[model samples]
Target: MTSPASTSSKKSSPLESSHRRVPTACTRCRKRRTKCSGTNPCRNCIQNASECIFQVEDIRKVTVLESFITSLKRRITELEEKVGKKQKGENGTQMPSQANPTEIKDGVRAPDTKQDAKCDDTRGLAKRDSTKFDIHLEASTSEAVYSAIFAIFSQSPSDPPSPVRSCSTDESLYNDVLLLVPSPGLAQLFASVTFHRFSDYVNNVFQFLNCGYLSLEPLALINQVASFCEFEGKWRYFAPDAFMAKCCMIVALGELYEPAYCVSPRNVRLEPPLVDKVPPGFAYFKQAVALLPAFIIEEDELGTQSVLVVEALTLAAIYLRVINKNIASSNFSLQALQMTINMNLHVAPLETSQEDRRLFWAAYSLNRTISLRVGQPLLLSAEEIATPMPSVNQAPSQKQELYKSEIHPCYIQLAIISEDICKTIYRRKCTTQANGVSSLPRFTLSMLNILSKLVRWADALPQNLKLDACLTSQGSYESHTELDRNRRFIYSLHANYCHCIFITTVPLLINLVQEQKQKGSKGSLDNPNVWKIIHMNFEACSISLRLYESLYRGKLITTYGFMDHDYLFSIGLGFIMGQLFDFSAYPVDISKYEFLKSLGKVFNILTNLLHNGNRIAHYKCMQLLDLIRLNPDIERESTKMAPVMVPAAVPVAIPPPVTVPIPHPNDFFLPFDDLLFAEPTVGMINDFYSTMSVDYYNLTEDDFVLFSDTFDMHV
Candidate 1:
């Protein structure tokens, strides 16, 4: 039995244990004022799914002091060894045997042991001194060979450090280093004048674009702009080049879409030549481009500044697309996508803020659109993306209106389906059969499945954004301003929906054309699925034409807009293919009168585009019209109508038709062949068709490559 006093002395006092504090707390627990276990990855941090960071100043100071003491000890040992060696040499006698090689042991000198030697060897291996051979190469001959090889590549000690460092340090001294950025006063003026117009454009014209592609909230952006204009010193808080670039982009987009800058169909013929007249926002856009190098190249870390850079790039891409610079727009979008991936924004764990997720999705959407348009593979695929779609409900009340929450998630779903179509249908594959047929059955099934999803997606849209609601209630919105905005939103959505339908069915149309060419029309038309596909494709083309006509009447479609022209061109080609192949032989729902009217509408739209300084549109219109006039069946139909289809509201006189000389098979003037391929073979034709099988909204000049065998088919 132990005594009571001895037992009390052995146990710690309760008061003493309660008063004791941990050495340090994790950042999360410190913020929350909660108890911490003082361990790496504290229990509270683990429970909260947060990172455990210990940034205690005392611990860092103590570590620095210990390093200082160890360094001092090393220096003292080296001096002592020198002194002992000098004494032994002067006295001509060996030092005492008890004096062993010294090593650092807890801030004191001790005898060097085998363990310390092993640690020293490990440190030496890690250092990997380039002047000497590697430790593993212990053989004398290997050392000699290594020394010989290293001598060839190594710089001489007499030589100064690289001149590259001089260039980097004095980069600002170069005359060209000074970009033509706007003065602060001029920049503020530009921002103030254009920002409201840009806001109005976003709210009215392109409402469907309210997805968080802008990254920052409108209020936040407005505040930043205000601060930038009022406080010249705000650059200290933000990256000057990146922030200014973003401001310039916002102003550029605003100027691009300003109502005063908007050209209606009636005014298109009155405008000057495209090359002679500067673009609406060219000045500001040029400034942004000049500043972009600083923004993109200087930043090495991922943060809010990097996110702003992505937004600027995205805005630049949109501006480029609007001005018909499709290739440049795609390149910008790809860069933004690559930046997002580099920042780990595509992964969920690194998505530290809602802005990051929004920026990631925006990059993804833009990249997917451009890649699909250009017939390029996606840099980041749907399967590889770990970030979640933006949620409207998760957004704050003030920002709820800024996000088209319901529409964006649905848009993401549609984008995924579009990706599936690209991967499954348009992906290049080798033909195994002797007939050069590759998985027609698999292709047909894939088309049907994708078409079903598209149909369901459109049907599931909110009532306000539904295609039927917008189409049926078109003229009813004349009284209500809110209803008109909804109408515009619905129009954009319907156009995308029609584009998806058209893209999904095009490959089937090509397959049907091929089958008919080989087995005759009757055998191909025997399948009921072929009839369904033909009717769906026809409806898609017709609906798209009508949508464009409505947008044209509203003055919402810009002549300089590449997407509008691309849509018209693609639909025109689809109609031409239908007429050339005589698809009316099948029991399709569309009548001959409706088909001719839609085709006539497309022809008129393209003709109007020709007068608007759209050089590509002129080429496209001529190619399409020539295809019609050259075909015997369509020529008869076209000749029976007026020389040119003109809308009644537009009083502009039609220009005289400039006859384009027909090119010989071997001539360099073959537009279609020159635009894409050198030779016109069936394989080249198939490749062109495959390119057209995806989205056409971002078609560049090179994408105008059509069937080069037009003469052969007509003959």
Candidate 2:
């Protein structure tokens, strides 16, 4: 058969040719100019829920060939001229072409010299064009292949730079800090006193140190110790473990001298206050971190994976965060988390000792919280976490009643709930939002399930643990310190509880706002679903505001940090949204003016926070304050509004698992009814954001930009 094929080669039909277009990318990926996995409904198309049609990509070989030919034409002419010149030279005639002209007269051009120069120039141009064309072709082909290969790969957003770690590690920069920091003896005394003051939370510190559990080898650095011991008195008897001593002193200094803990520290001024003054805990915190690597080295020699190592790291991370050294804090947290994993703490047996279990849970909680706080993906997933729930009965030996009182268990419970929120809602929300995709978890059924879980968790709490019961239980005869501390504890518990409620209900409120705006009754009070969800959000905001108001009035809360900031900011945002509820527009009985006044309280607290070292909260507070001021009528109405009866705390209820009707995600838009909120346009949001300090959290506006488009605004 091969011998018989000695005839002329046959031409293949275009349709039957081997060089056919075979699309390896979906249409969605092609439209996005991104790589596709080449699978049916490739990853990108799947995530965006877009069509995945694959069409043949026409290769423009003819165009490239034509350009390639055009580049060669000038060079072909140069070659012909050279051939003629060589033939003339072969005839032995004194060819003018062979004589090298030193310089040409202005009017007289040297033909051979000029032609050779032209030939070189043309050849270079042709080579460059050819190389560039090749590069373009290769780039196109390689990009497609690589895009397909790495279709699902995306870079993780980096964690915020921790201020603590960002500080110069050069020992000399801290020379002054070392001096201002308390002498080890006096530091011990101060720590002892502060620990006594915060004795209730001392176990948290102890658990963090693993002090009682881990046996540290006899410390050999007695001279290192002696230089630090400025006060040589009987107080020397008060020295705890060297590392514990540092941690305790660091936290004590943070509580006693940091403006975050109290207003008094702010009054003790430093020049330029913003940059000249270091935060209160900086000195001790820096020293502690400087000592960490050595401590870890020694601890690791004892055993590479000790709980003390994890605890020391945890303490460092927490104190780093406290001193506004977030980068350092996050670094330490990462180390601690890795250490926890190395020790298999997450999968430790349920029957492990309370100490082990407590350490593990603390690590789990700390890592998860930091991850969320810094906008990082969780290092520990729930599925990977094989540890059991911390029970009140399994309380650690120290302060049994305090442990048994359910403080920790309740906190842990909320943490677990919060973890789910972080994983399912916040994680997805943030990722999708970052990618400019507005997809949200299907809310109706998912939210109901989450709310039910929260309800069950809260309902299981002891009567005294309830927010309503606890607030009512405080008596007038109680001392200010006692009352303040008690209330703060209650406030913290309730704030976290409300935070869960707030996060869970806020999405529903978003849905309602979209529904109302679409119905052309943006502020109409007729829709029960709108009213019900709004009521829930208001309650969450109200509870948080009440706590801050009490704290502000008493001047008791010194540290209004992340927890406080989150609650305050969310509540303020809710109030701005609340302004959209026009009570006068309908015969609705909701206290719209009183609600604004309550929001006014949140604004007032935020205004105070501006001076308290939180830049983000201050900016948000100013925005809300401006929003209120711009709406003169709302401001006036709020001022004249009488105190409404505090709506009875909405009783926590779990609806018998029933699915509710929900609209599609695309139906929602950020509600910016200028008339409803008394702003000229949505540009006000962007304006407020522009004036805010540029921090990691404040820098991204996408979170707020969720409602960018206008839906139906006439019902």
Candidate 3:
């Protein structure tokens, strides 16, 4: 049975032979289904192929188009090489050590594996080196190759890692080997991959890419594939915006193949399997293409928005693949992503109603902008997408408007994903890391730091310099406010990235717990139940972290969630919580988790505070119960929970025992007073509420009842 990826590739049927695409149409299609006449097929079948029994539409024109694009690229590379050669000859002076471009790029091994001999001529490209380049940092498209790589570099704060030492590779080589080399980078990236280094074969092919010492036919075809599939991105006819989208897709895929991690830092790798996990001490390619538009001087406003579409499509493609069940599914998704890459959506090339068009652009822009990273471009109906952007600055004109609905939800979603990815990796690294003895995977502190910074790029969105205000038509700007939680998030992320590089545990766990508690304050973070959200985020974070750790450090001990809560227990949450309360007075989840296997440390901490005796801290813990009760908003509304920027001196005493009425037993009390706060056991603590004796206006104990007895519990 064909694997999904292979099936998708095979399912790509031959296109009907238009006079133009004859060279590519299969002989069977050319001969009208009954089968081909001979060699290439004849005019009868060629013309009648449409009339043939085979389905006219079964063919996936998109893949064929992709093939066309790849062809063109190969052609271009040839031209570039020829041009370079001529330039070299024109100089007439022999230079001793001019490096081949492919040779200069290290980590890329020379392909030595045996590929089908016919694959070379049929594909118009050979698989010499077999190593792939991760064109991350732009919209990445994984087309016309063995596999693609996506690389993301971020700066983290949780685990500040040490500085990275760059691993340089050879530059001046290009060969047909690229065709067969397939996902060479994955060797450095610890993950399940089909591509193993072809080694000896990678050597000579790269020279072919440097100068047109080879044929141009393959290159021409490659370019067409890129254009139609919106993969390679050339011909410049698909509109600049479409091209940009394609570029973005390329970068996204590059990042994907960047590399994966071990489940832990200490687990032994699967012997030979380790060989493909990455070259020794490999360094990430520093230059990026996504920043290209920003690099352009004097970029126009509309163009900037257009470019974002590309970013959306590109980022979407890469992220989607990470979670996708089938790698080949990306090819289909790629076409959908490519559609919006065109600027025609904005320009309204077709004849349509003004209102309709306006509304369409509005919604499209919104969905695309948010999706720019995730790649699942909103399948908004053209009508909704066309919704006029909220009056480009609150204009009086008859422009339709959309509410400010997209950002908050989108941000939340993104934050959630980023957080989860972070935790997944963290747990992974801890468990898989070698005892400073095992061979490490390729991805190291440097890459994790880069990933942190990339995620923080979200925070950079609101920075004063340039906001992607596609939605803000016309709003007067107020003086920028001081740092918000978003800013704090980015800062914290920076610290986490750094910590990861250095591989320190205590600080990492401490920060996540502390920071999340801060987020859980009044309502904002707590509204959504910040603790739960943190759990989910860390889950994802741990997965991604583990994936990378294995590649850079060692394999994980287990594939499930990366780290056991025992790590949490062993590190001693009580010690961390104590420090957090001391320094910030915030509340974290001291609550027991069902998923957590062991409950040793938490009980110990609770007992320690009780035994060792810190009254003030104990009072605060009791106070936290009261605080939780006072602000039922703790769970109802997330906004209220943002860490208090500054301590506001409110009346600390619980309203001097004031109370009015208690309709339901769930009714809240006037003020909180310490109740029977015995050892925290399985039963719910009644001390959550306070008792206060106020004047006549305030009620008595008979008037008040416990809210918990009747009120529903917060999830």
In model 3, the Cα lDDT at residue 445 comes to 25
lDDT of 1 by residue, 81-196 (tens): 67777888899765542254333332112223443333234332233211111111111111111122222222331122222211121222222322333335334435445444
TM-score for every candidate vs. truth? 0.59, 0.53, 0.21
Clashes of each: 0, 17, 210
Residues 264-287 of candidate 2 have per-residue lDDT tens digits of: 212322211132345554544555
TM-score: the better of candidates 1 and 3? 1
Ranking by lDDT: 1, 2, 3
lDDT of 3 by residue, 330-419 (tens): 332343333433444444544544433333333343333223222232343332233232222233232211111222222323333333
Model 1: lDDT to the true structure: 0.52
Clashes of 1: 0
Better of 1 and 2 by TM-score: 1
Between which residue pairs do clashes occur in model 1? none
Question: What TM-score number comes out for model 3?
Answer: 0.21
Reference-based lDDT, residue 600, model 2: 52
Q: How should the candidates be ordered by TM-score, best one leading?
A: 1, 2, 3
The regions of model 3 sitting more than 4 angstroms off are 1-296, 301-715
